[model samples]
Target: MAGVAGNQPLYICRNCKNPIALRSDLLSKAFIGKYGPAYMFSHAMNIIAGQKEDRKLITGAYSVADIYCCNCGEILGWKYLRAYEMQQKSKEGKFIIETAKIAKEY
Candidate 1:
């Protein structure tokens, strides 16, 4: 959490339970990428899998703020952007060290 960012280099997909390791430089882009950005995240994060039933979704669609499920490609969680209000309140007057750590790689 000193140099890169604290997102955990590895996270088990909550959907399929697959090991989701952060890819190297090539696809380091942050939409489900290594350096997660604000837009790639969803305010409401959850995991689910289902097919379309009668032209409708089997698993009601949800959202995530930060990461995605490596197995099912479903959104898993979210991160509070610096501009996000709730985070500002929680981390108010605190220092944020923007660096990558074992728990936050991708």
Candidate 2:
């Protein structure tokens, strides 16, 4: 889902219409918990950094912070795979945002 003008589409919070990310940055689709379908983003904008949380995945991973919408304080997503401190070869964090919570601006 590209954006208007045939460029990167804007991913905005459905509750407040605040910009969250761009479709071009989308990495993959995932279904987690009861949140339904969500998309992984290489990067996200306008996010309020929160606390770090632990996750049990494979060898386990942690989120750098619980991301929230800067405008409405809504839980946008999380930045995960923050094992850079242990494994230098590990990639940086990835942003995972629920597709239901946001809309594509096109």
Candidate 3:
């Protein structure tokens, strides 16, 4: 069955831990034929979490914190993928330590 984004539940950003409203324009354009299952499954069941550098440890420190909604300031999920460390880990370590696709909205 095709999932409708309009009728689907949207969670806030997991990073900031704030509420985020669905981006209507992006959502509408994302789905196919009004409301597509693939698009809804991808968005509704997906959470984009990003990590940032902490400039206070004297050394580079990254927190597994930060989840922001594209539409609004809300946290959806937390991840360890920092833009600086995105490609700094080995294959096994990357898989074991890093989280590519984190958890979903509850």
Which segments of model 2 are wrong by more than 4 Å?
A: 1-7, 31-34, 57-59, 84-91
Relative to the true structure, how large is the alpha-carbon lDDT of every model? 0.30, 0.72, 0.31
Positional deviation of residue 32's Cα in model 3 after best superposition, in angstroms: 37
lDDT of 3 by residue, 25-56 (tens): 12222222112221222122233455553322
Cα lDDT for residue 88, model 2?
25
| Candidate 2: 10-residue stretch with minimal lDDT | 83-92
Kindly give the number of clashing pairs for every candidate.
15, 1, 12
lDDT (Cα, tens digit) per residue for candidate 1, span 20-88? 333221222233223433122111212332331221112222221334443476554333223333422
Off by over 4 Å in 3: 1-51, 55-65, 82-106
Find the candidate with the highest TM-score and give its number.
2
**Model 2 lDDT per residue over 13-99, tens place:** 999988888778887875352366778788888888787765654434654577889999988767774663475224356777877
- Best-performing candidate as measured by lDDT: 2
Alpha carbon lDDT at 69, candidate 2: 92
Give candidate 1 regions above 4 Å deviation. Answer: 1-11, 20-66, 84-106
